[model samples]
Target: MIDAHIHLDQYDQTGIKEMINKWSENGIAGVVAVSTNLKSSYDILKLKQEYPNFIRAAIGHHPEEPPPNTRDLYELIDLVHQERKQLAGIGEIGLPTYKKEELYTKYSEEQFIDVLETFLRVAKKENLPVSLHAVHEEAKKALISLKKLKVELAHFHWLKASASTVNEIVSSGYFVSVTPEVCYRERDQLLVKQIPLEQLLIETDGPWQHGGPFSERQTTPLLLKEITTCLANILHIRYNELLEIICHNTKQLW
Candidate 1:
């Protein structure tokens, strides 16, 4: 099994290391540690070096941050080109749901779109896959743009989009990751129903959005099997079959 996406830098280093070691012990192959900023992207690179076979890195500026400068985007592109084989994709990048007034207080929507466009261009140039964070209308727009790019794979996590948009995503062959939150949240379950099993992948999105019957604490990749179980129940498929599909998707992207 593979944890398609996670934030290794967000967890306690020692705990994360131990947890990953345990995952290896449990027969998990590898994980893609994504970046939400420049520093974290570099950190992901270092992690890839440390765990060459077990960790893959994806570099991009997340929507939560102010849009990056052109120089920075160029540097990121250069890094991806130089380290193409080591990277899973360009990710954790897209538009936010904040209104224009709120967005301008930190960064303009135009700037966010610009950064997204830049990242899309880089992803196309590198012929790399991408993971997105946009929801609803924004997600729709991102999907339209991605279809025009050279993306090989696309994973949309924790989606909160309209049914039409979700349908479009599924039809377009993009994958959607269901987190453990599905076990406890009706909204996530609704999302699970909307996505087909072939396009569905399970994720932890660990250290954030943690829920379920387990400990009410931070999430980790170890809990991915729980998500798979929830998905299997919802999709009415065997657990192993669902696991195989997710593992295949992870390999296709990373």
Candidate 2:
């Protein structure tokens, strides 16, 4: 019951202990806590120190925003080297999809590609899995770089790609995750059907909102139960069966 991807640092700081306790009580084991920027990377790493068993940190610049400055990017790489043991992966990195046009106003698409390449190399150097944010056409673009760099362990978190692209990703032996959106979103359900049992992971991407059944609810790892139930139904398996398989899939990647 690990949440394969989440912006944990984005959650509220107050009463964090109570929140973790509740999640633990409900069978939520831990999370792959991803970073969105240099500061966020540090925050997640620090949180890992406090809750070593619960937080598997993945630090990197998120792609939908402007690229990191040279000094910050170098520092991030350095931080990764220093804390490689604590990291679950290099993550939340990819080319922008929703923000592509807006980001292009500030920096060229090539700049974003270059940044993603650098982070990919970092992940490769550390021999760590990556949690990617690339979706739509950008997912394919990220896949090209991963293949070029020969990164073997990757999780396309909350992936939104065509059927053909998903097949290619699955064939590459990388993992893909579904968020709680799978409970109500047909698109996510269809995405799950394309993924094999061994490569399927579940996440909440907590602190981010969802519509339908999850509307107005605070996103958290506990939502994994609902996601697991939905996944079980979609995959036509029993609840515990899907749980064990997903847990195994998560470990296989992270």
Candidate 3:
């Protein structure tokens, strides 16, 4: 199994080795270590070099942060282009949801749109899949931009969209990934039920924190077993069947 989205760069050297051992023990085949900035992109690439078989890099600037300077953005694009073949995709990119209150004031929504457009264009040009972060209304707008740019192979990670919007995303053939929240969050559980099997993928979204029973648990790929089990129950499929579909979906993305 593959963790379709995670910020592996956030983990330290010791944590990385521990994660690798856990993945091996848990039967996780690989992870898409998505990035949030130029430095993160570079770090994930280096990690990929060390564990080529277990890690795949997804390079992009996260929208929640202030937009990068022109020079920094240019450098990031150049680096991503140079390492395109080594990447699983361009991602951890999208418009900020209203929940990111500081971002709305610190970085204008217009500025956020511009940055997202740049990433969308880059993803389109490179013919790589994207791991998106847009949620709620932001998810709707990101979908619009993707369609406008004719960007294919998009995975909206931990997506929170209206039922109609989810239907639209699935109809358009884009993928949506669920996180551990699906085990307890009603919205995430509904999302799993609503999305088609072929379009469904699972992620940990680690090392981001979460609530519910997982409140005190360490967020790691090892938890995917429980997540997939929850999803299997929701989708009325066996654990192995759902896992096979999700694994195939991740392969289709790359």
Candidate 1 residue 168 Cα shift, in angstroms, is 0.7
In candidate 2 the C-alpha lDDT for residue 114 amounts to 95
Instruction: Pick the winner on TM-score between candidates 1 and 2.
Output: 2
The C-alpha stretches of model 3 lying farther than 4 A from their native spots are: 98-100
> For model 3, how does the per-residue alpha-carbon lDDT over 124-153 read when each residue is reduced to its tens digit?
888889999988988899989999999988
Ranking by TM-score: 2, 3, 1
Backbone clash total for model 3 is 0
lDDT of 1 by residue, 147-249 (tens): 7664647889778888899988988888888777788888888988988777777777767757458556567777887888888888789998888888887
Global fold similarity of model 1 (TM-score)? 0.92
Model 2 residue pairs with clashes: none
Residue pairs with colliding backbones in model 1 are none
lDDT (Cα atoms) of all candidates against the true structure: 0.80, 0.91, 0.88
lDDT of 3 at 225: 92
* TM-score versus the correct structure, for each prediction: 0.92, 0.98, 0.96
